[model samples]
Target chain A: SQTIHQWPATLVQPVGSPLSLECTVEGTSNPNLYWYRQAAGRGLQLLFYSVGIGQISSEVPQNLSASRPQDRQFILSSKKLLLSDSGFYLCAWVKTSGGDEQFFGPGTRLTVL
Target chain B: QKEVEQDPGPLSVPEGAIVSLNCTYSNSAFQYFMWYRQYSRKGPELLMYTYSSGNKEDGRFTAQVDKSSKYISLFIRDSQPSDSATYLCGPYGQNFVFGPGTRLSVLP
Candidate 1:
């Protein structure tokens, strides 16, 4: 079985501070990774997606960026955080076989104050 | 206009009642439909996936997709309090277009 791990489960960051959130998947290789943000009572907003290492596609332009440093390790980072950057971050993985069902991690709740 | 539209309902229903959740899409290219459930402050969990235009049933959950009408539905039989969460419908093709989601509360 494949499992995704994301941390820290919750984060509180000061405005203009740096942000880093990590997500790692086990039991799968060369999986498609995606970063999504969800606001209160809102649908998910796709931030970035990577089909392979060092390859990322940004859906919406913002302060946040994503990187796939390894085959199963994806990281979301920001040099300086903004108040609008606060939201629940989710990491998801999909098989390369064109299956649309994506498995998601527990998620990280970020609050920029 | 949005690619997909869903009623953002804080729908409250009694336990054991039947629940119906729906979504409409403007794109006909979406051949795959899916329903996801998300708890408070958690990631969305895929509850059901259906292809083309038809109905698929898994246990107490039934997913229906009508590509002709560009509409989809999810039906929960004998709903439980544990089923309280936000239901999001998505249309899949190159990627996915998700609806705003509907929050359901099953009162016990």
Candidate 2:
């Protein structure tokens, strides 16, 4: 069975602070990884997606960036956080073969004060 | 118009009642449709996935896709309090697009 893990399940940061969130997948290789943010009562906004190492596609322009440093490891980072950057951040992966079924890790609740 | 749209229903229903959730999209190129369920303050979980323009059924859920109408639906039978959550619709391709989740509360 495959499992996805995310760290710092809850984060509270002040404005202008640096941000780093990590996601890792086990039992799968070459999976499609994605980063999304969900605001209260709002739809999810796709931030970034990576198909392979060193390849990242950003869907929205924001204060965040993503990197696929390893095949199973993905990281979302920001140089400085904004108050608007606070939300429930989710990391999801889909098997390229399965294509449509996406598995998500327990999200990180980020609050930028 | 947004590529995908779902009613942010805060919909309330009695237990054992049938529930219907729907989404509409303007993009015709979407080949795969999926439904995700998210509990409060949790990540979304894949509940149903369908490719063809037909119905796909699981134990208590049924997912329907109508390519011609560019619409999709998720139906839940014998709803329970545990079914209270938000339902999100995703239309897929290179970048999966998620609709605004519909919040459902099943009263016991």
Candidate 3:
């Protein structure tokens, strides 16, 4: 079994501010990690994904970026935030060489004003 | 058109009622089908996973995949209020591609 954790849980940021949201996974080695944003009533949009430490692939062009500093530590960052960035941010992980079903974290609720 | 499509329904149903949720896609290469339940403002939790076209059941939940039509379905028997959430259908390949999600409310 695997567990995914994300923080700050909830956030309120002003426009043009810097942002950092962290996610970590336990009980798995070299797993694939992903960052997703969910707008009101819309499906999740993949921001970035990493197959291994320091390897990232961006799904959409945006002001947001992701980094995998460690095998299980993934960080989503923005140098300057936009109001459009406010949404439910989720971190998901899948087995590296197995199933495609994603395990998701509790998620971070961000409100940008 | 998007690769996957789901009706974003605020579907209201009474307790003990049967619930059906569906999604369709244009891609046939997708071999993995998954269903996830998402509470309001929370991350989605996977409920079912199916490979290719087939039918699989787990307790009160049944997931069906129809590759011939590029469609997938989830049926909940004796639904409960606790089942209220947005349901998403995902067709995964190298990665996962998800539907917009259908919001379900099992009213008690």
Candidate 4:
């Protein structure tokens, strides 16, 4: 069975501070990874998605960026955080051979003050 | 219009009652419709998915999609308090486009 892990289940950051969230998947290789920010009542917003290492497709351009360093490791980072950047950050993955069903990690609760 | 739309309902229902959740999408290219359940402050979990138009049932949950009407529905039979959570519906084509989700609370 495949499992996804996210670090710092909860985070509190000050404005203009740097932000880094890591996601790693176990038992899968070359999987499709995605980063999503979910706000209250705003729905899940796709921030970035990667098909392979060093290849990322951004959906919403802002202060956020994502990088897939290894086949199973993905990182979401920001040089400076904003108050509006506070939300539940989620990491999701889809098997390259599996259908459209996406598996999500526990998620990270980020609060920018 | 948004690609996908669902009523953001904080719907309260008694335990063992039948629950109905619905969503509509404007994209005709969406070939797969999926249902996801998310607890408070947690990531959305894929519950069920259906291809094209028709119904698919898994245990107590039934998923229905009407491609002609661009409507999708999830039905929970004999709902339980454990089922209290936000339900999200998504239409998938090139990617999955989700709704705002409906908050459901099953009162015991």
Candidate 5:
């Protein structure tokens, strides 16, 4: 059984502050990780995806960035946050064995005031 | 047009009634489809996944895909209040392209 974990379940920060959200997966290795932001009543917006360590793809250009420092650890960071960054931040992972089923972690609710 | 489209319905239904959710996609290369259910303020959970056309059943839920029409559907039978949530559908091509989601409320 694989599990995805995310930290700082809820965060409130002022605009221009730095942001760091972490996601880790257990019971799986070499998984493809993704970062998504979902706004109220909107669909999930893909931000970044990592196929392997040190490999990240940006699906949308924004204030955020992602890194895969380890096989099971992924981090989403920003040097400065914007008011528009307020949304539900989700981290998901899919098996690397050519499967498309994605498993998501409990999201981080970010409110940039 | 968006790659995938779904009615963002705040659809309301009574308990024990049948609930139907649908989505449409424009890509002909999509061969895999999935339905996800998300409770308020929670992550979406994968409810069903099917390949190509035809229907797949799991317990009280059924997932239908029509590749010819690029239409997909999810049906929930004997719905409960617990079934009140937002449902999302996606077609897998180069990636999973999800719809805007349909919010369903099964009133008890």
Candidate 6:
């Protein structure tokens, strides 16, 4: 069985502070990774996705950026956070078998004060 | 028009009642449809996925897709309070277009 892990389940940062969120998947290799954010009471907004290491596609223009440093490790980062950057961030992975189902991590709740 | 549209419903239903959730899309190129459930402050979980048109059932949940109408539905029979969550419908491809999601409350 495959398991996804995310850290700092909850975070609070002031505006202009740096942000880093990590996601790791065990038991899978070369999986497609994605970063998504959800505003309060709203649906998910895709931020970035990666097919392989050092390859990332930006879905929306924002202060946040994503990186696939390893086959199973993905990181979302920001040099300076904004108040609008506060939201629930999710990391997900999908198999390359042509199936569109995405498995998600527990998620990180970010609050920028 | 948005590629996918769903009613942002705060629908409240009694436990054991039948629940119906729906979504409509304007994109005909979509060949796959999916339903996801998200609890408060959690990531969305894939609950159902279907291809093309027709119905698929898993236990108490039934997913129906009508490609001709560009509509899809999820039916929960004998719903429980544990089923309370936000339901979102999306189309599959290189990029999935998600609906606004519908908030459901199964009251016990």
The candidates' DockQ values read: 0.80, 0.90, 0.85, 0.83, 0.78, 0.82
Top candidate by DockQ = 2
Kindly list the per-residue Cα lDDT of model 4 for residues A38-68, writing each as its tens digit: 9867789889999999999999879999999
Q: Report the C-alpha lDDT of model 2 over B1-108, residue by residue, as the tens digit.
A: 999999999999999999999999999999999899999988998898998899999999999999999999999999999999999998886688999999999999
Which pairs clash in the backbone of model 1?
Answer: none
For every candidate, C-alpha RMSD to the true structure in Å: 0.9, 1.0, 1.0, 1.0, 0.9, 1.0
Cα lDDT tens digits for candidate 6, B1-108: 988889998999999999999999998899999999998878889999998799999999999999999999999999999999999999896676689899999999
Which residue ranges in model 6 land beyond 4 Å of their true spot? none
How well does candidate 2 match the true structure in TM-score terms? Answer: 0.97
TM-score for the first chain of model 6? 0.97
lDDT at position B3, candidate 4: 92
Q: After superposition, how far is residue B96 of candidate 3 from its true place, in Å?
A: 0.6
Candidate 5 local Cα displacement, residue B28, angstroms: 0.7
Give the 10-residue window scoring lowest on summed lDDT in candidate 2 chain A: A94-103
Tens digits of per-residue lDDT for model 3, A17-80 = 9999999999999999999999887999888999999999999999998999999999999999
- Candidate 1: residue B65 lDDT (0-100): 94
| Candidate 5 regions with alpha-carbon error over 4 angstroms | none
lDDT score for candidate 4 against the true structure: 0.93
**Pairwise lDDT winner, candidates 1 and 3:** 3
How high a TM-score does candidate 1 get? 0.97
lDDT to native, each model: 0.93, 0.94, 0.94, 0.93, 0.92, 0.92
